[model samples]
Target chain A: MKKLWNIFKAGLVTDNPLLILMIGLCSALAVTSTVSNGIGMGLAMTFVLLFSEIFVSTFRKAIPSSVRMPIFLIIIGGFTTIVDLVLKAYFPELSKSMGVFIPLIVVNCIIMGRVEAFSYKQKLVDSIFDALGMGLGYTWVLVGMSAFREVLGNGTFLGVQVMPQSYQPILFFILPPGGFLIFGLFIAFNIWMKNRMALKAEAAAAKENA
Target chain B: MKGNARLGLILAVFAAIGCGTLAVVQGITAPAIAMQSEKALNESLKKLFPEAASFEDITETLKSTSKTVSFEKAYLVKSAAAPLGVAVKAVGSSYGGAAKLLVGVGLTRNIAGVTVLELADTAGLGQNAMNDAYYVNKAEKITFPGQFKGKYLTDAFEVKKDVVAITAATISSKALTEIVKTAADAAAAWLENQAAPVATPADQAAAAASGAPAQAGAAPTGGK
Candidate 1:
């Protein structure tokens, strides 16, 4: 139980998909336009990541050391394909909204990175916990970024008007450039906070030594 | 294998696998992808004339010939009524790059409506031109394009200021307007040759089947 807790905790904070691990940044940047699109993409990524990671872990011992990377890639590509086909057939609207980015999920560094890094080295149960944590981490960050952009950019929440008429909408919030601007600002702010925490950590370490 | 040799072999194998994976995906998805495109085209027509109980290719003759006609003819997607609208593929340069719209104007020949079947455009601002209320309204309100609705063969094409372009969406407006004019002309030419034979209810069922949406909701590239 303690081991499981450690795995889960590591994934959420220490190696969060967006913050610490910094994988899947492409979709993170592109689809973080609206909460709906973000959530749709997050769910899609979670399912894909969970299955691919598990499948890779299951086959890790079987794969010849000579061709493990190739095998791993084929697995990831196949899973991404199935996701694309299923979504196109069933959830056409979300598929459309996601656009090319859905297919681009095959190239998402996160899926491949986790499978190659942690899952390949870990046990099945540990990997599952890791996947769950990472998935939650991805979903939450995407939702947070999208919520920030949507409300401020559109003057609405989930498409409902939140602000009164007195406020004028900053049309730029919905533009493509605006996405880059907002994401950059958030990333910068996070980096600053991290540096501040690091300084505090160093100060505490110095005081302890003294 | 030595460490360096093994690394090289692994890299080569990985590259081959990536290429092979892409090939397999591109191969299998290619046909489905192409079919989805046809579905999108047909769906666009259906949206314009849902009541269009039926549709037939009156202008398909233009596609058969190898003769170089600078001006290719357009096609008709008729409703169960006397005839619903003119379905034509149009290409124009929008804010970003070349934009393709499948326009189906009313038989009245006025700018009825359109679907940006393909577009590589800036998202949201200039791209909003795909929306009905914006592009369709602006195209028609200007009177040059929409006025074509009810015009006979002799009506010359025109674009006026009243067809107010979206605030920052001029390129899109220009591109669509050009396509509409060419398509309207081609449609008019095709109509002149053909007899106004409206299809019976039996024909409507077949057309309805043909007009159902392509891949329902395919991935959105940059298009709407």
Candidate 2:
């Protein structure tokens, strides 16, 4: 259980797909304009990532290294289509808002990276934790960024007007440049948090030694 | 050689499984997807003509006017008592690409409403053309599409000069205005033909040929 928790924590903080690794930044920036879109995209990605990890881990030995890339792609593509179809059928509004980004999930490097680096070698239980941790980590960052952008950019939160009636929305925050601005701030904050944790850990070790 | 062959076999097996799974999922969702689109179309039509009990496709009966704008479909909105108006779906070039719109024109020769079906305009700028919350007149709560309601078919559909353009989205605004105008023109021409008490074969043939009936006196006077 402790080992599982550590693995999950690693995916969440020490090795976040966005803040630390920064593999799939394209969709992250594009869909973070609205809070609902951000949540929708994040959940869709998590669903795909979880299923892909499960399949890859379960069939790791059977999958030959020579043809693993193709196999991985097929699995990933199949899951992405499922997400696309389900969203279109049930959540048509979200499907419309997200547009091509859902299908584009097949190419998101976070899933590919995790499946290749962690799931390919790890046991099923460990892979599951990793997938959950990574998925939530990605979701939280996307939601945080979207919340900031939507409130300031559109003067709304989740399509509801939350800002005062007199507040003038800054359109720049909703554009591509604003995505970069918020993303940079998040990264800087993450780095600062990491440094503080490191300093505290070092001080605890010195106290133990004394 | 044996190892390579084995790898290929495994890859083929995985591909087959993947394809089979997708095929099954697609089969399950295909009907639902079709139903959703149909429902969405119905909802849009209902929103445009709230009193309309039924809509009959009249695309074949009407004639398209603008060379640039293509008329995709037209529907004759009717209540149980009488024909209400016409809804025309038209497509035109926009800043990003093709912009599709549905324009509802009443029998009284005024626009009932307009809704954007598909738009590929830039986010926050051109995209606001369809956003109901992005009010052109914040005090009156008049949206980009809201401004078109009750506008006469003969009114100049020019962006900025007449129609309110989306802020910093003149190209998108112009493209949308043009599409709406083309649709309104088509609806007006069709309505004029419907209102005519008697149509001679020659007049019908001429209307079909020129896309503007010779006896179009009742038609709203407009030139794109």
Candidate 3:
């Protein structure tokens, strides 16, 4: 149980796909304009991540080293297509709004990174935990960025008017530059938090030694 | 040699699995996707011409007459005995890739409105062309699709000079304007051809005589 907790914790904070590792920043920044968009994108990516990890770990032995990358791509591509088709069928509005980004998930490095770095060496259960933690971690940050942007840029949350009447929305928050500006701040915060935690840990270890 | 052969076999197996999964999912969803697109096109056409009671596909009319610019499809919009005008689906090259639009040309040979169907331009700049809500309070500057309403083809659709280009997205704005111009020209040419075939010879002669100024006025190069 403790071992499984460690695997999950590593993905959530120590090795987050977006904040710490920065594996899939390109696709991540594209859909952070609204909390709904963030949730949709994050969930879609998580679905792909979870399934790809499972497939990669299951076939780790059968997939020869020379052909592993191609195999990973195949698995990821298949899952992404399924998600794309499902979205188009059931959530046509979202599918339309998201455009080509849904299919582009096949190329997201976060999924490939997990398959190679963690899933390839780990068992299926541990890989599932890692995928969940990383996926949720990425999701919460995306949601945060989106909530900030949507409220400030559009003066709404999930299309509902939330801001006071006199407050003018800043158009810049929902634009591309806004995405980069917010992403940079989130990265800085993550780094600062990590540094503070590391210092605290070091001081505790020294006190124990003394 | 044996190891290489095994790798090949494994890769083939993986490819087969991927293909099989895609085929199954596509088979289940293809019909739904088609229906959704059809519904969306109908909805967009309706929105573009709110007054039109119905629309008839006249893409064939444009294809048979115009050769310089081609549209994806053209629709003849109508309400009872009145001709609402024609709407054409045109594509233009944006900074990203293609910006697709449904352009409505009214009976008076002026632009009625433009609705962006698909835009894949940069998120902030080119996308401003489609973000009409962004221009609601900031109407002092550029207004998209709204600024296009009621402008005649004689305007020649020049960016910045006639239509205020979206800030930082001149390429995208230019592309969209060109697309509108192309649709307008094709529509005007088709309307001219439709009017020409029905005129009697005496009327044709009279049209040639007095229509000279009208022809000059409606010329595709009127304002370039």
Candidate 4:
């Protein structure tokens, strides 16, 4: 259980796809303009990541290293298409808003990196927890970035007018530049938090030695 | 050689499974996707003509008469008692890509309403053209599409002249105006052609040769 928790924690903080590893930043920036879009994209990515990890882990031994890349792509691409079709059929509004980004998920580095690095060697149960952790880690950061962008950029949260009507929205917060600015701040904050925790851990170890 | 062949076989098997799975999923969602788009179109048409009880597609009829401007889709909007007007969907090239618009033209040659169906333009600039919340006239609370209501089909459709342009988005504004003009002109020509069916072939040829249909000159009777 502790090991599972550690794997999950790694995804959320120590090895966050966005903050630490810094893979799959394109969609994260592009879709973080709205809170709803962020949540929708994050969940959709989670679905694809979770499934791909499961398939890769379950068939790890059977998949020869020589042809594993193609096999991984097939699984990832198939899952992405499924997500796209399902969103179009059921959540047409979300499907429209996200546009080509959903199909672009097949190429997201986070999924590919996790599947290759962790799931390919890990057991089934461990892969499951890792997938969930990584998925939620990606989700929380997206939601955080989108919340800041949407609230400031559009003067709205999840499409509702939360800011006072008198408050003039700064258009800069919603643009591509704004996405980069917020992403930088998030990385900085994550680094600071990690540093603080490391210092505290070192101090505790020294105290135990004394 | 044997190892390579075995690897290829495994890859092919995975590819086959992936394709089969996608085919199944696509088969399941295809119908629902079609229905959703149709539903969306109907809803937009209803929004344009609020009192419209039903819509009959007149794309073929309109296509025959509308030689100057082409429309993607044309519909005869109708109420319970009588035909209200014609609605046409037209596309114009914007800065980024195609901007699709739907314009409803009343029988009195006045624009009933205008709606944007699809737009692939630059975000924050060109996209503000269709955003209702981004008002062109804050005091009047008038949206970009809102200005088109009750406008005469003969009015100048030039951006920054008769049409108000979005801030720093002249291309988007011009594209939308062009699409609206095309839809309105197509609707007008078709409506005129339908209204005056007794004209001789010579007169029809003259009208077509002129490249502009003669105005019906009928006074506005407030089409209910």
Candidate 5:
């Protein structure tokens, strides 16, 4: 359980797929214009990530080392297709709104990276925890970025008018350039926070030794 | 050799499982997805022509008769007695990509309403065209597709001239206007041909000869 906790912590902060590792930057940037879109995409990614991790780990032994990548792709692609179809059938409006990004989840580097790096080597429970942490980490960053964009860019929170009527929305925050700029700032903040935590831990350890 | 053969078999088994899973999920969701889209289209049509008691899909007939403009589908809306209006589903190239909409033309050759079905325009700028609140606030006085409502079919319908373009979303606004114009012109043409069907060879010859003048008076030829 402690080992599983470590795995989960590692994914959330120490080795975040978006911030630290930066595996799935494309979809992250493209869908971060609104909170709902960000959350929707994050949930979709989580669903795909969690299921693919399980499938990869479950079949780790049977999968040939030589053709393992291809097998992993098959599993990931299958799960993505399921999510895509389910979204289309049930939430048709969201399916239209997300557009091509749902299908593009098949190529998101985070899913492939997790399957290759952790799931292939880790046990099932640890893999699931790692996936949950990484997925949530990715989700929170997306939500944060989208909240900033949606509020500043549109003067609204989740499409509700929050600012005064006089507030003229700065359109820059919701554009493609704004997505990149916000993403870079988020990454820098993540790195700074990690360093600060590390320094604090070292200081505590040094004082204890003294 | 034996180890290589074993790897191939394992890979094949995994592929089979993946394909089987996809097939099952697809089989279950395919019909539902189709129904959803159909329902959405019907709802949009209903919104555009609310008073109409029934809607008859004249997409194939419109396609066959429409000489120049290409529309996805055209529905002939009607009450109990006479034809009420026509709703044409059109797709146009916007800044992002394709933007699809439904334009309703009443029997009097005026726009009843314009409903944007699917738009992939940029988030803040072009997307404002699809925003309901942006067009609904009567205080602001600026509206998106609502500007096109009640517009006569013969009007040039030029963006920034006849209709106000969405701020910073001129491309998307222009694209939607062009699409609506195309649909309106096609519906007008269909109405004209319906009034005077080309049954005889002389009438066909006259239609072919007067096509240029008819297009000019009826539908503006160039993309505004």
Candidate 6:
């Protein structure tokens, strides 16, 4: 249970994929038109990332280091194709809305990054845990950013009216520009928080030395 | 030295295999991808007119169908449906990129259907205009070739008098109405030259011809 908790904690913060590491941002901008879409993409991406990490870890030694990138790409692309076809066949409208992003997962940096950086070195079980942590981290950022965008842009949550009618939505928040604006603010906010934490740590150490 | 050369040879061979693998995958998926596109275009057309059993490319590039000496000639999309036979498309810059819609007509130019093939409007607002709401439910019955449909080339109503444009989308509206009008004029020119009869819209008659479902696309082709 402690291990599981650590996995969740690692993903949700400390190592949040998008905010801390800046990974998988293409679909972050593309599918974030709505909260539901954000959720859909997050879950689908998490699944692909998790399974591919597992597969890669199991065959890590068998794969020559030189050809690892190509092998990882094929794995990611094949999984993304499956997800794309399933969405197209089952949820046609959502499939249309997701559009080019589904195929684009083939190039998403995070999937390839995790496969190479973590799965390549880790044992299979360790790789699975790392994958779960990273996938959750990715999902939380999508949901969080989508939450910020939807509420401010449309004055709603998941499409339901959240803010009262009196609240005038900053309609631009949901547009393409909004994606960049929110991302920039979060980057600043994270830097500020990190600096504050470091300052407190230094003051505590200084007083102890004194 | 031998180790380095061996390594380089292995890398070259691996790179060749990678490219070959990509080629094979592309070859397999290309046909399926093309088929999906064909299905989507056909589906969009069918949604406009249930009677449209089939559609031919006719001319693929839309720029070739232009008339009225305003925009370049653009291509034509012909639909063979009766009673409410008509073509529809909006033209102009819809907020962002070039905006144009083209639809087909049959008898009475009473607005058979509308197609929004190109758009670059604000995603949630004007882009919403292209969704099933604006295109399918609200604006399905609008006739195209705004002026040529009802009025002859000898006398065309000003766009303000004849067209119904979506509010807040004036540029797109003007572009769309012009494309419709151009398609009408071009089709009329071609048809009259061939001595084939062409039917244009009669708004008052359609208003009286109620009892039919609310005309989805018959809103005047100009802006509010």
- Measured by lDDT, the strongest candidate is 2
Per-residue error (Å), model 3, residue B26: 0.9
Superior candidate under TM-score, 1 versus 6: 1
lDDT by candidate, in order shown = 0.64, 0.87, 0.80, 0.84, 0.83, 0.61
Model 4 TM-score on a 0 to 1 scale: 0.85
- lDDT, residue B165, model 3: 80
* DockQ winner, 2 or 3: 2
Candidate order (lDDT): 2, 4, 5, 3, 1, 6
DockQ of each: 0.14, 0.75, 0.58, 0.69, 0.82, 0.22
Clash tally for model 4:
0
Segments in model 1 whose C-alpha atoms lie over 4 Å from true places = A188-210, B1-47, B57-75, B89-100, B117-120, B131-162, B178-182, B195-224
The positional error of residue B109 in candidate 2, measured at the CA in angstroms, is 4.5
Clashing pairs in 3: none
The RMSD of every model to the true structure, in order and in angstroms, is 8.3, 5.1, 6.3, 6.5, 5.1, 10.2
TM-score of each: 0.70, 0.85, 0.82, 0.85, 0.88, 0.63
* DockQ leaderboard ranking: 5, 2, 4, 3, 6, 1
In model 2, residue pairs whose N, Cα or C atoms come closer than 3 Å (at least 3 residues apart or on different chains), thus clashing, are none
Residue lDDT tens for model 4, B102-186 = 8999999999999987775655678787687877778998778888989998798888888888877898888788778877876
Q: What is the TM-score of chain A alone in each candidate?
A: 0.84, 0.96, 0.93, 0.96, 0.95, 0.84
**Range of the 10 consecutive residues with the lowest summed lDDT in candidate 4 chain A:** A167-176
Judging by TM-score, tell me the better candidate of 1 and 3. 3
Error of 1 at B86 (Å): 2.6
Ten contiguous residues with the weakest lDDT in model 6 chain B? B60-69
The deviation in Å at residue A95 for candidate 2 is: 2.1
Judged by TM-score relative to the true structure, which candidate is superior, 5 or 6? 5
TM-score of 3: 0.82
Higher-scoring candidate on lDDT, 1 or 4: 4
Please provide, for model 6 over A1-210, each residue's C-alpha lDDT reduced to its tens digit, 9 standing for 90 to 100.
677566555555556677778888777876676788788888888888888899889878767786677677767876787677667655666676666567877787888988998889888877788788888777766777788988887677887889998998786887889998887877677667667767997999999999
**Candidate 3 deviation (Cα RMSD):** 6.3
Mark the regions of model 6 whose C-alpha exceeds 4 Å error after superposition.
Answer: A1-8, A162-167, A185-210, B1-47, B50-63, B66-102, B108-111, B117-121, B131-224
DockQ of 6: 0.22
Best by TM-score: 5
Tens digits of per-residue lDDT for model 1, A96-125? 667667888888888888888889888888
